[model samples]
Target: MSLEGFLAASARGGAIPWSEELRAAREFGLSAREVEAAAFGAGLLPARYSRNAGTIGLAGQAVLHASCVAVAGCGGIGGHVIEQLARLGVGTIVAVDPDVFEESNLNRQILATVENLGLPKVEAAALRARAINPAVILRPLRARLDSRNAPSLLEGADVVADGLDTISARLELAGACARLGLPFVHAGVAGWYAQASTQAPGSSSLSDIYGHGTAPAERGVEAALGNPSFTPALAASLEAAEVCKLLLGLSGTLRGRLLHLDLLAMECAEFPI
Candidate 1:
């Protein structure tokens, strides 16, 4: 049967179940992600994404299913962000992280597990994401993101997500995203505090906040207070929401604004950039 016919026939109440999508993927020699996209293109929803329909809608789901996102770090905030984006059905995820999961990461990094302590963070993220949604493509780049490679490393992504811990790398990525004309969704976590924002290209938002070329190697406060398990998830959730907004072309994004969260006191504040 034709994929379209199969999808149309398999759909119930305008949505296709996972079992049917999987069967179609196997029958059509396509990835589950591709089949999901076909379902969307055919005006049918994937059942697993039914919960997302009300908020995302069919148009938003189509947008998200066609979007590609680059996650610069696969630990802590990065892991959580990747997981959220995967569940949210971003079509392709380019997960970049050079570090291995050491015992230290187990405290807050979602991708860190005792059995996979020595594995690369990107690989672990891929495993987790694939498990969550095989319809989401996982691209693992087990390399450091730097100025030299940032352009090529992130060129095709619709948005670049920040999960880096150092000022130097964040600045580099923010600058590269500016040059690449890509939107950057940034988040940082330390102890009970986290901040998130979306920066448009050439906004110099990160530069304005961190200053340009002034101690690029400096690490953020996470180095001092350390990341508890909650902060990264909090920050990454904000980042993932921003990503969804950007992909869906929705308004009220954090562009030119920074959101600060005091988890300890359960307070939230927004500051203009």
Candidate 2:
């Protein structure tokens, strides 16, 4: 069947299975992602994303598949963010992290398997994303984002997510995102507490949160307490949701505000940025 005809038929069923989508892509000489995009555009959700239909909507699914996100620091939070974005069907993910997985990362880093010790974090993220959803394209960049290379590294992304562990790198990336007019989703974790925010372009929230003048603290309390496996996933989920909301043009993103979660206390609160 023609691509349009196949999509239309799938629309009647309210979703298209991956096997059929793959067959159609092969038949039409298009990439699986391209076919999935067409399927959503034609008002059908790919079976892998079917459960997301009512919540995300068909048009939103297409939008997500067409959107690209750059995740700086694919370690603790970046690893989880990349995985969630891939499963959510975010089309292109730019996974950027200079370091590699090690024995220390097995504690909280999802992409860091014992088998992958010494593997580059970005490459590990790409591998996980593919395993989760091959239709989602992940571009792994094995480099750190300094002020000079931040823009070029994060170019073409609709939103940039901050998972960098250090304050300096986060500051540079936030500045770059602001210059590019891309919304920046940021989260910081230290011990049992984590805070997340969405900084819209032109906002100095990062500098405001981190402060002006000589770098406040090179690292947050996490440096002392260490990432204890739960905080990164908590903060990363919020960041991933923020990215998803931005890509789908949904309301209620944490723009101009910050969400603080205290896992130890089991309490969460939101504060204006």
> TM-scores for all candidates?
0.96, 0.95
Best by lDDT: 1
State the C-alpha lDDT per candidate: 0.90, 0.87
Worst 10 residues of 2 by lDDT: 6-15
lDDT of 1 by residue, 1-273 (tens): 789999999988988989999999899999898898888888899998899999999888999989999999998999999999999999999999999999999998889999998999998999999899998889999999988999888868999999898887888888888888999899888899998888897777987677554665477677789989999998999999999999998999999998999988999999998
- Residue 229 of model 2 has an lDDT of 96
* Clash counts for all predictions: 0, 0
Which runs of model 1 end up more than 4 angstroms from their true locations?
Answer: 211-213
N/CA/C clash count, model 2: 0
lDDT value, candidate 1, whole model:
0.90
Model 1: how far is 16 from its true place, Å?
0.7
